[model samples]
Structure formats: C-alpha cells, structure tokens
Target: MSTVSHALTDSATMLRRNLKRMVRYPSMTLQLIGMPIVFLLLFVYVFGGTLGAGLGGVSGGRAEYVNYVTPAIILMTITAAVQGTTISIAMDMTEGIVDRFRTMAIARVSVLTGHVIGSLIQTMLSIAAVIGVALLIGFRPSAGPGDWLALIGVLVMMAFAFIWLSVAFGLASKTVESSSNVGMPLLLLPFLGSGFVPTDSMPTVLRWFAEYQPFTPLIETLRGLLMGTPVGNNAVIAVGWCVVIALGGYLWSKKLFNRESTR
Candidate 1:
C-alpha cells in the first residue's frame, strides 16, 4: 500500500481493536454515556432556572432555561473523552504495551492516531446525544448550514489539539496517577466559561479570564452554530488555538517517541 493508504489502513485496524477493548469493558462505554447525561440533567433541572433568570432569561422564561446551556455542556463532554485518552495512554505505558508495540511492524504513529480518532468518534456521539436531549427540551440553533459546518470544523480541530495534548501526557507519565493530572482544570471549565452563565455575570477578573480563555471562543463558536446566533470574533480565535496546540503537540510528541525508541 502507498504510505497514505497504509497509514489509513493501520489507523482503521487500530481503531477497531481499541473499540473492541471499549466494548469488553462495558463500564467504560457507560461512563462516557452516563456521565454526560447526568450532568445535563443536573444543570438543567437544579441550576438552569436560577441561571436563566441571571442571563435575563435567554429562552424567555425559567421553563426554557435548558435551551441555552445545552450547547456549552455538549461541547464540555469532550473533557471526558480527552482525559480518558490520557489515562488509557498512560496505562499502555505503565503496562509496557506501548514499548511492546515498538518491537512490532505496526506504524508508530498509528498507535496514537487510532486512540485519538476513537476518542473523537466517541465524543461526537456524546455530543450528538446531548444535542438530542437539548432539542427534546426545546433548544434550537438558528445558525445556518455553513455556520453549523464551521462549528463542527472548529470542534474537530479542537479534538485534534486535545488528542495531542493527551499524547503528551501519555509520553510524560511514568505512572497512571501522573497521566491523569489534567483532570481538575478540564472539569471546572464549564463553570468558568459561558457554559451555564454569560461572561458578563462573572466578577471583572473572572470575566476577563473567561473572555480571553481559548475555551470561550470555542464555546461561543459552538453556541452560534447550535443557536443560529452570531459567535462574533470567536471564529478566528478558536481556529488559531487549534492550529497552535496541534502543531506544538505534534512536534513534541515526535521528539518524545524518538527518544523512547532509542532507549
């Protein structure tokens, strides 16, 4: 096969194997599914009403509070997928699975690409489910097709960035504990972003952070796509973030793999 064909074939094979492993551990699938759903219900029911009033009632009343928060939370589900990537990669390192792969003829990059692609596919499903629930609860995006497509483009780009981020953790970790260290900040992000509330409601300092954070652009871009509203200047910023992080991660991971192989 041509190099491109070979890479594609290897990536598919790797994805299938990883997915089979995901199936065997049904709980892994459950956590990915259940965790996002639970958060959706909690935020929409418990906090949505109060937060809606605070946003000047975006959906018009306390009853429609669920609509506005849906997109933010849906995008937030990637946190689970990305963090899961880090731990799984870490486990492979700790158990010597990755080291063993080095002795085989398998494509070196496929090992990372497969898991990243798998996680992205899983995250897409979770995002879809969250959207479905949001629609059922009366949320709808007014954004047109092109805008929606742009939203997905940014999301997929963000996924690539995060996958590389996960790979770096995988490369650096000597233990499983060390691998999972990116958790706290990722989980707390929705609270900090326009996820459940607008940036204006936050204190000046936090609003500044929230306004300037890379995630804010991502969330806004997604919000415009889903809600059919304008995302303002977030489009440029979001794409820029994706490019910088993905390139940086690729360069770092390439070097790390070379050293590990030489050892």
Candidate 2:
C-alpha cells in the first residue's frame, strides 16, 4: 500500500483502540461530559434570571439568559472534552503504551492522529448533548438550517483546534496531574471573554482584554451564528485563531513526540 494510505489505515486502527479505551473506562468520559452539563444547569437555573435582566431586561430573564449562555456552555463542552484528551495521552505516555508504539513499525503519526480524531468525536457528541439540554431548558436559538450548519462547522473547527493543543500539552507534561492542570486556563477563557456576560459590563481594562482575546471572537461568532446576531468579521477572526492554534499545537506536539522520551 502507499505511504499515505498506510498512515490512514494505521490511524484508523489507533482511533478504534482509543475508542475502546473510552468504553472500557466510562468514568472519565462521564465526568468530562457531566461537568459542562452541571455548569449549564447551574448558570441557567441559579444565575440566569439576574444575568438575563442585564441584557435589556427581557421579560423572561432566565429564558433569555439561557439563549445567551448556551453558546458559551457549548464552548465549555469542547474545552471539557479536550481536557480528557490531555489526561488520556498523559496516561498513555506514563503507562508505557506510547513507548511500545514507538518501537513498533506502525505509522508514527497515527498515534497522535488517533487521539485527535477520537477526542474530536467525543467532544462533538458532548457538544450535541449539551445543546440538547440547552434546548430542553428553554434556550431558543434563532438560527435556521443553514445557520445551524454553520454553527456546527464553527464548533468542529474550534474543537479541532483545542484538541490539538491539548494533545501538545499531554505530550509535554511528565505526569497526568500536570496535564490536567494545563487546560484549566482554557476553562477560564470563556468566563474572561464575552461568554457569561457582555464585555461592556466588565471594568474598562478587563473589557479591553475580553474584547481582544481569542475566545471573545469565538463566543461572538457562535452567538452570531446560533442567535442570528451580527457576525461582522468575527467569523474570519475565529477561523484565523483556530488555524494558528491548530498549527502551533501540531508543531509542538510533533516536536515533543519526536524528541521527548516516553515515561
């Protein structure tokens, strides 16, 4: 078989391996999926009314807040799932599986490829579940079919970007605990951005940071796509950010994988 074809086949096999591992250890997957749902429920039920009132004091404040925050929660879902990727990769590295793979004749890229593809599938499923819960809880989006497709596209791109970065983090970390800690800053990005509230509501310096940060454009793009808000150049900016992140992560991951000795 051709080299590229061989890599693809090996990647597929590795993907299956990771998927099986996920099935074997359901707790980690459940925990990753559950956290975002908990956050969604907590924000919508507890703080939604007050938060929504700030957004022009819509009659059903909670309902309005639900729509406003669902996009952010969706981003969180992606972030949460990729955090698992970091832990899973770290475990493989420390547990000696990666060392074994390195000595084998299989395509070298397939190992990381499998983690990226498998985690992406898990992340997308988690995103779908979160969206379902959001809909059930009165989060109404105004997007039509095309808009929904666009939103999904945006999400996939964002998830892909984050997962690659997480893989890099995993490869860099010497322990599972450190891998887990690396993505905590990512979890905070949405909160610091325009995810939970309008950047205008934040202090002057804070608002400036929120406005220019990568997550702000991502959140704004999601809001525009899902809620029919003005998209403007947020889509372009979001895609640019994703590309830069994905490229950086891929390069860093390759460097670490090639140079770092497996624990």
Candidate 3:
C-alpha cells in the first residue's frame, strides 16, 4: 500500500480499538458526563433564582437561569471529555503500549490520530447528552436548524482545539496523574469566563480577563446562536481562537510524540 493508504488503515484500526476501550471501561466517561449534570442541576435549581435576578433584564427565575447557563454547561462537557483523552494517552505511554506500537510497522501518527478521533466522538456524545438534559429542564433556545448547525460548528472547532491540547498534555506528562492535573484548567476555565455568570457583573480585573479569555467568546457565540442574542464579532473571535489553539496544540503534540518515540 502507499504511505497515505497505510496511514489511513492503521488509523482506522486504532480508532476502533480506542472506541471499544471506551465502551468497555466506561467509568471515566461516566464520571465526566456526571459532573456536568450535577452542575446543571445545582446551578439551575439551587442558585438560579438569585443569580437570574441579579442579571440586569432577565426575570430572576430558574427557567431563565437554566437558559443562560446551558451554553456554559455545554462547554464544560467538552472540557470534561478531553480529560479522558489526556488520561488515556498518558496511560498508553506509561504502560509501554506506545513502545509496543513503535516496534510494529504501522504508521506512527495513527496511534495519536486514533486517540484524537475517538475522544472527539466521545465528547460529541457527551455534549449531546448535556444539551438533552438542558432541554428537559426548561432551557429553551430560540435557534432554528441553521442556528443549531452553526452552534455545532463552533463546538466542533472548540473540541478540535482542546483535544489537541489535551494530547500534548498527555505526551508531556510522565504519569496519568500528572496528565489529569494538566488538563484541569480546561474544566476550571468555564467558571472564569462568561459561562456561569455575566462578565459584566464581575469585578473590573476579573471582568477584563473574562471578556478576553477564549472561553468567553465561545460561550457568547453559542449564546448568540441559541438564544438569539447579538453575536457581533464573537463568532469571528471564537473561530480565530479555535484555529490558533488547534494549530499550536497540533504542532506541540506532534513534537512531543516524536521526541518520546525517539527516546
């Protein structure tokens, strides 16, 4: 087979392997899914009334808070899903599986590609679950089919960027524990942005950070598409950030993988 054909076949095989592993050992994925669900319930039912009231124009009700918070929660789901990617990659490295693969004649990049594609699929499922829960809990969106498609595009871009970053974290770490630690910032960032609350309501310093941070633009773009809010330049900014991060992370991950394989 030609080099490209070999790479494609190897990647497909490895992708299937990783996906089966995900299905067989589902604890991590379940935990990731469960975290967002807990957050959704806690914020919407427990704190939604007061938080919703605090927003300038919206009615201080659980329903309004639910709508406002769903996009943030969706972002959180992606963050959580990527944690699995880091852990899986780290484990594969530390357990000598990568070394075993190196001795094989398969395309080298296929290993990483498998992890990336599998993780993306799992993250998409998790995102779908979160959105379903949000809909069930009175989180109404005004988006039509076109808006939903746009929303999915934004989310896929975000996932692509973050998954590559997670792969780099995995390759850089010496242990699965360290990989988990490195990936934590992905989960924590949503709170620091406009996810749970409005950036305008935050103090000046934090407000500034929240406004400029990558997640803010993503959240705002999602909100615009789903809630019918004015998107302005947020869609452009979000896509730009995704492209930058994806490129940086892809390059970093490849460098790390090559270095480790050489060692």
Q: What are the per-residue Cα lDDT tens digits for candidate 1 across 1-263?
A: 78888878888988997888777876766676667778888877788778777666435544556767776776677776677777887788779887888888778888888888888887777677777776776665677788778767777888788778777777777888877775547767777878778888889999999988777888877877777777778878988988987888778877877788798
Q: Mind giving the per-residue lDDT tens digits that candidate 2 earns over 135-234?
A: 9989888899999999988999999999999999999888999998999989999999999999999999999999999999999999999988799999
Q: lDDT per residue, candidate 3, 1-263, as tens digits?
A: 99999999999999999999999999998999999999999999999988887764555578778889999999999989998999999999999998999999999999999999999999999999999999998988999899999888888989989999989989999998888889888788899999988888899999999999999999899999999889999999999999999999999999999988788
Backbone clashes under 3 angstroms, per model? 5, 0, 0
* Candidate 2 segments exceeding 4 Å error: 261-263
How do the candidates rank by TM-score, highest first? Answer: 3, 2, 1
When summed lDDT is taken over every stretch of 10 residues in candidate 2, the lowest stretch is 55-64
lDDT against the true structure, each candidate: 0.77, 0.92, 0.92
- Top lDDT hit: 2
- Give the Cα RMSD of candidate 2: 1.3
Q: Model 1 off-target regions past 4 Å?
A: 57-59
| Candidate 3 lDDT trough over 10 residues, lowest sum | 52-61
Of the two candidates 1 and 3, the one with more favorable TM-score, higher being better, is 3
Clashing pairs in 2: none
Determine which window of 10 residues in candidate 1 has minimal summed lDDT.
56-65
Compute each candidate's TM-score over C-alphas.
0.91, 0.97, 0.98
